[model samples]
Target: MDAPVSTSPRPWSPPPDASDVVKSIHAMLHPRNIVVVGATDKPGNYAERIWNNLIKYGYEGGLFPVNAKRESVWGVPCYKDFASLPEPPDHVLVLVPARLAVQVIRDAAASGARSATIVTSGFSELQDEESQRLAAELQQAVRETGLAVTGPNCLGNLSAGEKLFTNIDDRAVTMVQGPVAIAGQSGAIVMAIRQTLEDRGVGIGYMVTTGNEAGLETTDLMNYFVVDPSIRVIVVYLEGVRNTKAFRDACKAARAAGKPVIALKLGASEGGRAAAMAHTGALAGSIETFDAIATREGVIRVQNLDQLIETTECFVHAVTPKGNRLAAVTLSGGKRGLLIDAFDAVGLNFAPPSPGISAELGAMLGPGSIVGNPLDAGFAAVVDPTVYMRAIKLMIDDPDTDIVIIDAELPKAPHELRERNLRRVNDMAGEASKPVIYVSAMSIGFTDYTKELRQTLPHVTVLQGLDRAVTAIKSLIDYAALPKQVPDVASSSKPSARATLEKILKQAEGAALDEVDSKKLLKAYGIPISKEAIAQSAIEAIKIAKSIGFPVVAKVVSPDILHKSDIGGVMLNLTTPAAVGKAFADITARVKKLKGKPKLEGILIAKQVNADLELVIGASLDAEMGPVVLFGSGGLDIELMKDVALAGAPLNEADARALIGRTKAGVKIKGYRGKPALHEASAVKALVGLSNLISDAGQRIASIDINPFLINPKTGVAVDALIVLNNEAARQSFDKSTKGKSTKKGGGH
Candidate 1:
């Protein structure tokens, strides 16, 4: 069938110049010829701090300081302006006031500077009209001159690869150079990540903070890092993303490149969203949507900075295991118990050794040693260090073990003995394809001695804190277990179907659709709905019920009312014409007493079909993700139970089945005790059908509710359907404005 007809503004996109983006990033990362505007001799000023960092960090490139009042800044030549510089520099650091930032950028651009870092505040982040106007001018400058800008309210960036330290961080002078690259929206968070990694003797390859993100967003930097050959892992400190499509694409690219992207996302709570909005001018979109995309794109999300650091460190050294089975070896029984609990908490299974292997281990350790999973080798390993090494090797070689964890007190061992043990394990890891982790049982902090060991033996993953180590491994396994992304099916609404829906929506205008029209719209998409007819009077109702057959159901139809049962507007199991007539009269009388005296259109007569289970399938529009689908248990307590699974729309059969499997009702639907298993493919078909409707309608639809859909052994049929249109109150941009005109009142199911 032909795709839906009409125009829906496409999802947001980034800047359109690829070459310009690369050149800009290159200039930011490798600014050999630099000019610092607003330089001064004031000791505590931003300019002085930046100059000190450049000098102390041994920047081996030419630097020119711009200041009309000073002759020089810390013995470096000071130019009066960009025009006065010896030659046009590649980059400029603007330390001027917010009002003058645009003018400075204009001058820098005129002088052929490809990129500029505006170290000024008071832009759209302030959320005021005047500040927004200033931000607009700054954007104009970049657009008109083809120059790349980092921030108008930001804490600049640092490049370790080129020794180009442009940020106001003085302590960055001593940062070690390594393979991990960090891109963050918050400058302070980036600095903190660098310090935390540096304290552990982990060097950084590149560090960047896209403050305010006026010209280049964090996703832009992520896209750059995914392709950079030197970056093995990418770390992100996220508040929000302006362009969601770019962020998702970047995550996919990173996954395809075999690089792990670790993120610490804030704004999970309402208070956090408020704080995040005040801090940065971002929407702080739904946490649920973020989670769905993160899982789909293979981005590893963490709760806190510590988890972020721990996960990144683990990925740097550990190999992705083929399965979630873990073989843990701890010296202490108490520690072994702790490992079992931790592993179970994170859903990691313990792999039991085979009988032959168990016998060999039992003979090696002698009596009293537990030879099963979570093996406590007793004092045999401590007495003879060679024994522990041999046991570790045996676990690594076991077919059932995909990950090997050894909890040891390395600091207590003799220095030489510790070295020999770690070195052998590291060498063994090189030969074996599986990952081997060394968990510090003592909960010790990193010291010079440990730093030396990490630097010397980089292959063995050494992690501190037992709980943190297990949590990190769980994350690794989760990442490894993600199924390959399924190619999307051709699920768009056909032109004829779209036109039918549009006509129904137009006829109803801003009102809620009655069951007849709702069912009509759904039926166009091939979704099964119960056979029924609308009857305007008691005589007609009785006739319709008889035609539908005995044991029919009747519900009041109204454009002004929702939730017919709440108002006594529904009657079920009509066995005779007398019952149908009386039920219709009773529903009409009951709805008349409702507070607002809702308008009653007619009574619906439907054939009652036999069903083994009830299910709910729905779809709606999300501000960020566009379209979203939901599946869960259906009935009066669907809200109380809240056992629903949600995902972004345009779903294939695989995605639909995954969503269905996450609910308690799904378990019952599979087969409860002696009950026969219902056809799950029926539910999957309904979900995909709903997804297509949402995608085709796009922003024109407000919401959809299909509750208590009956599922029998052969098929699932919609017994009731409710569709709400995108009225003035339901517009996507309704909530952002502080002032608005009054809107018409309407009801939705």
Candidate 2:
């Protein structure tokens, strides 16, 4: 069969000039020289402002203005073009149309200026076919010339140490230089965050906005950021990711570099998804999907601009909450209560300062401050603002307290005093490299001071709002604790992605398997099966019952009555031949009554096996996670609990064991309380055994339901199982079975 038709766009791609554009932004940071391609005094032109801002911002780089229309722009002499420059500038800033932006970059690249900022929009995102064609043509030019572009619609980039200047917010222009490097797709968002950083008085190393992300994607720019010694914290405002594999690799590289990447990713809703597809011609990896990959890959995803900035700071500044412990220091009763609720919601908690220290802090302040985990430093700060420092020091110094959080709003009277207190508290936290979260109730106050503190103490992550303050801390804790990758079981049997299994998984179809067929497929996979002789009639059923054993389970094994008990399709616990004969007739008769017709497949007498616990595990293809295994409470209601834990199959013993523990059944399977535990480890091995079988069989199995896999508690034998066979459905059954084994006994099976 042919592959499905395409609907999602060709992943978002910026023009080759896009990086050249971003490089232009990066160049402004420490450019040897900057050449303005469309320099002019025209009121609407960006030339005068660019020239003026370069000079005003104290850019030491030489400036060359090029405008055929003017000899000077903002009092700077203009060159006709790049050929006229005395020496090539490190960056060529272009504020021209799309067609001209390409030429500007080509000129720059030819002149050894390999980077150019294109502060011009109107390309593919505009949905103008002509413009898109032009955009593609321009992109080819940059690629051929090997120059990098930042944006055609981007606001431009920034580097504080380089003293690079573009149209970034003026407030951010005043911000100092530091280790954080921001690569944003949304110019407005990056600038806003820059402003926010500036408001907090934090210094930034570089701010790159990949407008329309035409060429130098966030990952491409980050590729350099991960290696740049000057950048410690990487913040990104992402509209969309063009290449996930590239991003995943970059994230791994960044993690190894010890650089915490805080990302503000967009495109969550249906409309947003459509826009993402259209804007960049890229698939909108949904928020949750993106989160899973990012989390797995070590990229911290944040929601809003606020989350973007705060999380970035925490990632850079704070260590993981050592032991799920937080210390909340707040003044107001309401604030403290809110903090508690927020902490609970986020799955983090305040470890009250140790009794010895809590007592000491209380004594120092006496009746003034309510010293507890949520230390009410409010009352004490009024008496001695240094009490803020004292309270913070108390929390940070506490051996049991891993994280200290101050949720307070201090007035601007004491910049020096607060800085002293902050640094003192900073020193205390620095002793053990502990983390501190400062939450200013209002967004307005202490912007400058907060910035100063964050810059001084890279680990002191500050935020606005009580909820944000709490959530950021908790998310940091949780995100840090997440495992890197679940163990892979497919490599267990060294299963080489057999063609047969692939075909089975890709295209299989069938209803539930008959018991005999289930065992036949298991036999193919090297799974053991019970010895049973099928009896064609009541006489045969009794004869087989006696031949097999006296006490046997006479089950109505027919595909018709899938739920045997509902229609009296099963007759169990029979010891005598006479009883077995009666059960054979009764079960078939009952089925006839229920369905108005019953064609007996014959009665099979199977040995009755004692079980400690029933495990139900199988696989059903999850469109998202792929052929994932499932484990849950066994018996009929396995559907109801869905108490499943899964892993992709071809599992090894270790992977199988983990798969068992991953389910709610771990404790129960291990034997809970006084009850004898099932042989989970052995059962896991059995599961691995079965999965390898399916992997080997290829196209033969659809789904395997190890329902009521009467596991012998003492010996841990998987005494009974049902393997469904059909098509690709069976290929996925391996995972479903592994995930479906149970813990809860239910009312009864």
Candidate 3:
């Protein structure tokens, strides 16, 4: 069978010079020489901290501190300016005030420096005219000189591979180079994440804090890290994204390279969004829209700091699970119960052991053993110690298990029995085909002995805290299940259909289309709308109702009245001409009695559909993510219920189905209780058609709301719809196409 054609908009792409930007970032991170501007001996100054950090980390690069008033900084000879330097610096660190930061960047660029990190804090984040102006000038300087600058209000960055530490953060004094790379808009967040990962023995390859993002944004740093061979996993701490296209490209690049990009996105709450705006001068757009984009790009999103650290640990040390099936073993019954609760909260279930494996475990642990998943190995394992090793090995070898987890604790003091047991388990883990994780019942502080044990047993992933461990395991499984390749969106809209839709839109007289006109647009896109027609008079309405069917619905057709039912302008179950005529008269009278006297276009007579389920499908242009589609329960209580799921559109049947499955309405439609399943395929078709309509029209249509799309056992049909036009686009398109023609007041055929 041939695949259905997609009419969704093409995926957003970064600018053509994205590769060039990445190359410049590489040069900046690996600079052979760095100059720190505004260097001084003033106690507790930013320049002093950066100087001390660079020297402390043993930076091999030629570091020259420039301060006109100082002869030397941190016991290193200081240059007066960029031009007085003996050699051209590849990167410059600007620690001067906001007013002088732009000139320093320009000077560095003019002197052959490829990149600069502006540590100055006064920028748009201050929310003042002068600061905003300074930010603009800084941006202009970067553009004119083609210098890849990092920030105007940031704490700077560090490169562990080069032993380059330019940041003012005191917590990250030790340089530990490993497989993880960190990027964030908040310097404090970047440093905190670095500390957490480092404490867990996971070394960071690079950490870049892009505050204000005057020139170099977080996306640029992400793109650079995706290509760095030393970085195996990328962690991002985002308040908001500056460039949507570039961010998507960077995430996709990481996914294509077989690297996991874990993001700790903030700004889900109202206060958090406001704080993000104040902190970085970046708009923290809708979290739903951000989540939709993240899901499509295969980025793993974490909620808190603990989840972020633990999930990163999973990716760094553990192999990807082949399936969702998990096998957990614990010695203590209480710990087993905690593990079960944590797993259940994350929708994870332990795989039931096979009969043979169960029998073997029961026999080895004696009759007291509970031989299911989360198997309690009893006190026998405690007495012999080898029981744990044998049981873990059995679970790993079980065909039903994809991943195995065992609860164990690292000894604080040296004990021969504990060390011997751990060593045997670790050796078994080394030979196991599946990933074997050692989890603690609660969050634990790492001891010197714990660190040594982890270092010695490299094959075992020790996850502390049962809740965090489950969250990490869930993330690992979810990431592995994500599609490696992004799907392509190829347009296959029929020319005639698109032309008809445009004509309907161009003819729309008001900002919002009346029911008759909205249905016309939907019908043009091959969506099944109710059999209906507009009637200018009672006699005409009666005639239209008869044509539709015996039982029909009559609604007041007015561009001004969006909610017809609220105004008592809707009449249902009109089974005769007399009923239809009275309904038409009543609807017109109700509209005339309104305070503003809303213009009544006519009466709409639509076939009354009796269905088992009602669903709402919609599409709107998001500020950051272009067009997004929504699906959920419908009817008048839609706002109250708020059971909606959103996804970036134009959607194929599969995407439509997935969107539907996220809502409770989807489950009901599939068949709730004893009720039989409705026509879900028809609903999928309507959603796809609506998505294509909005995507094709772009900004011409602002939003589309199709509520109470009635679905019977056989099929679904849109009974009511409203299309809100982008007022500016509608006016411009209307004027351009209908020049010198008689303008229509209301959309009536």
Candidate 4:
């Protein structure tokens, strides 16, 4: 019989809906022909192991070996180089030194090979100038030749779908082919996860290690997995992603395809971030940014390896609970207490047995048996084991039960009895709409037969520990409840506002806009600001303060100073003209004493705002995810606690309302602990306006900082404003302001 031919076209030969780059990646992952570069007769070498694994795994493709010093390698005829091959192979595994890897890729490209896996290191991971230079060279070769490369320092990939195994581990040759596709930056993690999954009998379809990611990133593989018919879930062990746009696109694609992506991303902690940077040369982005994107994209994030495996095992049952309500049944009363505590800690709700159901259980057990959520069946289960099944069946059939969890000390029981009990439970679960997860409370002491029972069982999950079980259960519920709406990330609108903002940004100077001009920009977006004026001297400051009214606020205006109060640059409650005049002189004198001798624009005199609460609202552009909005407690504590909530910008009022509600600061705004309830809607409106500002001037604006935006029941007033512009925008604004300007001041808000 002849080997089957791949329907997939060659690299650079794209289908109608795909591009050449995507076609190239597809061929690399699922190739029909492969040639081993640097193939040798030496036993246990990387090339020898890969070549033998291909044959052992029953790879149905043309295999050619390239070895300059040998005529034959491992009983296969060896060619001298790519020029000597009979035909162009679909992919090549280049096991050469890092310095020579680029040349090998160029040779492969010239020979018409679509892809090459450069199994070499000493590139970007070193975090030095020379390594980075080499990495850049590799990237240039890939871009110039249009060849898809997996790594310059990586463990090769394995495609069980094609019976292709090139990873260092020969065990991959025998792993079962299934729906899960795993991709990562660390080769060890990729192989470890595969082994863990395979140990539990969960087969994998594709496993790829994107070391250094100079040419291909994890996102690229995710995008491909989204469309692959053989995959139902995508798992990734990520340090970080340099290409955030690609990550977002791939996540969205997976969501659209109804494939869930499970990510175990590192870099949430300082130590983890350092380790990740050292290991993969990944500049870990803000953890908050990663979390926000994950939430918006419906990607499931787990903390550790244990959760990864357990959650995946649970997903294999493929049951999506309708709600978080859980019905738990345990054989031991002590175990019931532990289970209840674990569930409560993670916010899983309990479904208490109805009165009639409780009464029935009471009569059946006769007495001393509690019939409630975490139901502790009577000691009758010890003598009559049928009682366990009966109690569990009743709970499973409850109308309020979205999930059923059973905890049992199976290791203490005879294997025969435990297997019988579990099999009956499995049968019951298989027929129900909700998923059933069994908690092995004493998993450490479990018999081998019991462990085997868990591994080999169909549609049955035996989670090891109580805490992990609760988390898995909660994650299952959260995934089921993920909102279906596509995320709206700053859709372009407000053409008039965009034009005005662009003009203003184009005319600004230095890094920041002074208070007067910042207020002018905010007013354009409909945010209310106190009437104010910039006064050039003491007499001018007195006159402006009087016009604003008595008890006005005076702040020193400068392009350099960020925190006015810290530098004694602010004076509040200036009731008299003399006090206003004195405050202006005092601010100027203090600012002059500060280091760097900041250029003071003028004294900004504004009517003091009286409000029920103070709030801080800010907007900034994230390098990875574009615009982001921040809301937090205002006043001096803003920096102390840093208690803030964040959301991607260009949001509507409803989204803004949800965003503000996420923080402790928002709690106080809504009348927490005997405090009067301030109008929260006013703040929401201000946030929406800020979002508009970001969307309108995103290219020109770097950040917008508004602290202590006074808020009352009906309105929010910007007490102060500071807008930072990008360099080009700042330079443009500086040129405009410096040319033929007398006072270096703008009109009032």
Candidate 5:
């Protein structure tokens, strides 16, 4: 097949007219005739091998060699060049230097050679001026000729069963003619997996290494094979997907075709995945997002290539283990039973073989051998080898068994004993057409022999990590019995910004958000709070306190000072006007003494709040997900515990309500210790509203602080509040501030 030479600019891309190039090159991979460009008397040239492998593998199709410098290299008469070929061979495999390879491709395209494989590199990797020129010019050539590109820095492709073989070290290309097609960036992984597949006698339809993915990228290959009837399983090994539309569409197409696509995309860690994601924002599709998409789209996303293979092995064998329910029949009852317990811990079901089968089993085994669920045939199988066969047939007869797991352990009498039994049951199960899982306890004891057996029973998957087997079971069950939707209850539309106050302080300039600024943002978002006042002096503070009644708090307002105690900026517990005067005097003197601290705007007094308990609700934007609401045990424990769950912004209010349900404060508020239910629903609703508001503000929110959100059975109010605006502070940062100093926690010296 012709490999494409990149012609894109600094960040290489396929030519403008690359579709036809890709199609034609794709066609050449399965060509009837191949013409070798630069065919010579060289012992191991790429072109020579192309011709030899084509013939060596019994490709009865036509072979044409085009060379400007040699004559009769492979016995078939060689032509001077492509122009001299009998009829412009189907594909021209060009083995030339980087400078000359581009023209050779153009000549091949013009001479009717559908595609050209430029098996030369030094194009973009070198970062040299000429290589860049060559890469761009080559890409232009594709636009000029509509020629498809495989790679300029790639190992090329191989489809062994179709006789499309090339020794490009794409590295260990195996001739497995199965139903899976693999697309990979790492030729080494592709090679390793191909070998593993071939070892299992599995066949492959297409294998491509899209290194750098210049043109005719991974998705093009995916899109093409998705429609191909012969391919039913698609495996992708990726550093990343450059085009989301193409990648998604290809996956959709595969699903539409009932093809199972197993992907091992590595990103989300290390520089490679990050680089892959950052360059294209391909979503490197983080694990959570990827799993969600794959589940929704019917794509099986695996972690590494090994899991990719293991998952594929199950699909290829058509082993659809639907339910977690498992029934094991092993040679050793103890070993299989132990495995069953392990499976249980992993959330796997151990379904007992039905009664009728047990009776039928009674006749097969002597009166002594116990034959029930987890039919302990392992010990009995030793006494009677044929007993294994009887147990298997009876187990399959039971309607209760969805998957029959065979735990064959004890060493046999050795006449190719395990193989014989395996063949018998394998053939039986093949005819039965039911899912059968195998775990060789005997093989587990021996590494070499175990590997050997695995090679033979390639259809049987050897699940990794006992934990992994459970995970696999759970995933499969979930797939079969997945729910349509996860319910979301709208909890609140209030801004959950209280914890964000610190962020605001950092960006604070000379002026701070006044109570009006703080309350405006909160009020606009619908968070309920007390009515209040911002009086400046002792007399004014005393009058406001008397009106709000005896128990109001007073504090000096200032953007300059944070800890009100250090500066005597706050005065609390003002039951009498005389007490208020003395508190007011203390705040005024302290403010006059502090540097870089704002003078007291006034002593504000308002209705003081007394609630059952104080709960802190806040919002913080995560590095990935923008804004998140966190609710947990409040007070000093907040920092110590960090026992908080984060939920995305624009949160469902019901989700907010649910968030409280997840916290310890919820139990207290919901009537623990006979405590009446606070306005719990109202508080949660407020938090949810805050989360949405902050999310909408996005970068505009620098921080917010609504500490000690007082909650009682009947009502909840934020006693203290602060709002940090963005680079440019929001004018309405405190719309949710107290109506007045109906608060405590005042500044004090």
Candidate 6:
């Protein structure tokens, strides 16, 4: 079952000491000896396949198989249990029924096994009471015995460098060791990624499937890979993260070591989240929060398997580009057009050729070429292959180009023309100062000859399909352009400011604060709010409206009525006292006629402020990620537009500005069409204030919404505000206080 979301503060704690986790994970991945607990030679048995794989892969360590029913299997002795073994193994593979898996782990631990992989299912993933009890017992076993465990519902792991293969998949037999390490929550995804990388000539150094992650999580594997010397890039396929802080730290460590980390994360859509929950019993957090974390930590996120494979290939083989500028040369005009379209779709543009370079290409290609960003070399290059190399050289030499691409293909079999042309392009790429990549017109599998060509030109980066190649290029450039420093959370608020907010919260009675009280909270944080006041009667409302200004806005103030305008409780452009009085009477009468008699808390009379644009800025406590701030287009159609951006809060100035820039409201605020630019600095200040407010007292405040925050050229003002308190937290606080008072009275007696 999914864990309940908490309203209290869930402060992120630092991960366990790095050296300790790394040491434990290293032992699990590179065990000295392995024992198969449920090993048998019965047909279609998982343990039998795993036992064969260990022997087939040439594992040099000791391998002991245990089964009470079998005397001997495959010329190896089968023991009854862990107690009967001659010596304790360092690792144990448990492939028994769910009811017996916990006992097997206990036996393995008692026999001095340091780690184990539980391949049995029926744990928390089953989401039944019995399954949960088993899961709890397994967790207790690991904690009591200090045993490093991999999974209770997962395939086993593999260490390519050590020739240790414990996985049950058939594809594990052919995985070649390389510099890339793969860690995933799903076993099938791990094998699929491993196959794709190896098929594309990218070797895999390590593969780990952290199914259910009963004891060891994907973050543990990530920490290990970051410190390992042989690994250069880390690939992760995750349904959800167990520890947010540890995950961030691992990504940061990889970035510091100059190793790229690519993630293919699920749970962006509702169905995907449901599937993840059913598959692994993981509570998938919001995708926006994950994206914010990924961006902050400099991790590359891919949308699909193709993008993951293609992006990984580029990072492994190609040099990082200095900028987004690109230049390409193609032999066919149609291919060039497709390249342009692909690049444009991803918001990338090719570097326009310099006049000198364009003229030189025009003269050299006999005026048949239309030279631009993606220069087409024309059909003449088909006869005279030197044209391809010379054009590539000029494009690479151009001052504006940061990376160069050339459309070409490797021959499936030895052909004189194709081989000669490919060789020339390879030699040029070898010497070019800028990064150069080879692109095929369409996606194709590698033939034996293609593999041979790749071996010869190990430095050349080859990408298939125009769309996938361009997407990968964008990832490469974006990764290269990331800032070196991760922005820290905005500084804490002053003690006086925090104390004032706390006092207001303690005095509030209901779950939600009315607009007047909400504005009071905003004003304490230095956020500009509309000039408003609450009036108990129509005469008082008219008196306040006249004092504020001639034209004013009157809104009903009630904790029960969140959407006041929907109940005809809001009156705008009240030009006189008569109008304000009538609005107050109308709003109260409408509330009285409602099906449920909601308690009316008078009306608010505020000055009407003209705005150039309407925007929403708010902050709330995320169950997993803590405080998060949201900004988007506001007004009644806020839900319909759905154009917004979210980021984990306590945001610095730069983060706040970047969050705004991600939304469409940011574009309109920057003088869209003939509109003059509004006060964006004011908006940034408000967002930063809201972020800091939530971070300071997020335990008490459930959410703070400032919708339709009207902005003009001069400043921005919060026209409507709503603050929802964490009702659970308030009750807990009250209970604690009452208990303390009762204890003191009893002591006095």
Residue lDDT tens for model 1, 436-551 = 98887546777766666677777778777777788789888888876555243556667888888788877774345777888888888767888799999999988888787989
- In angstroms, what RMSD does candidate 2 have relative to the true structure? 11.6
Query: In model 2, where is the ten-residue run with the lowest total lDDT?
Result: 273-282
* Deviation (Å) of 364 in candidate 4: 2.8
Cα TM-score per model: 0.88, 0.66, 0.89, 0.88, 0.63, 0.89
lDDT of 4 by residue, 177-205 (tens): 78889998888888888887776657798
> Model 2: runs farther than 4 Å from truth?
1-30, 168-172, 268-285, 316-322, 330-334, 352-372, 375-392, 415-423, 430-432, 441-444, 447-461, 478-497, 501-749
lDDT of 5 at 128: 74
Model 6 poorest ten-residue lDDT run: 272-281
Q: What is the lDDT of candidate 6?
A: 0.78
TM-score: model 1 vs. ground truth: 0.88
| Cα misplacement distance, residue 591 of candidate 3 (Å) | 3.0
The residue-level lDDT of candidate 3 at 260 comes to: 92
> Model-by-model lDDT, in order?
0.74, 0.63, 0.79, 0.75, 0.60, 0.78
The clash number for model 3 is 0
Clashing pairs in 1: none
* Model 1 vs truth, CA RMSD: 8.8
Model 5, 1-749: lDDT tens per residue? 32212222221223454455345545645665666667777777666666666655545456677776766776767788767665546655656788887888777777776655555676765667998898888778866877666656555567555566653442334454568888776666776677666554456877776654445667778776765556778887766555544666667667666677777766542211211211111122244334433454556777665556556666676465555567777666577667777777856767656777777888778787666667777666778778888888777667777777676532323348767777666666675545776654332333445545555554454444444444455545554454333333333442345334334444456323555456656766777776668777778877887777878877666654433545666566778889888888887787887765565566556567887877776664322223445565554355565444444455666667767886678778788987677788768766866776666665555445565578887888766665544432232222222124332110000
Candidate 6 off by > 4 Å: 1-18, 268-285, 367-369, 504-511, 672-675, 725-749
Which candidate would rank higher by lDDT, 2 or 3?
3
Error of model 5, residue 44, in angstroms: 3.2
List where candidate 4 sits over 4 angstroms from the true fold. Answer: 1-22, 127-130, 170-174, 268-285, 409-414, 441-451, 487-493, 673-676, 726-749
Total clashing pairs for each candidate: 0, 52, 0, 4, 70, 0
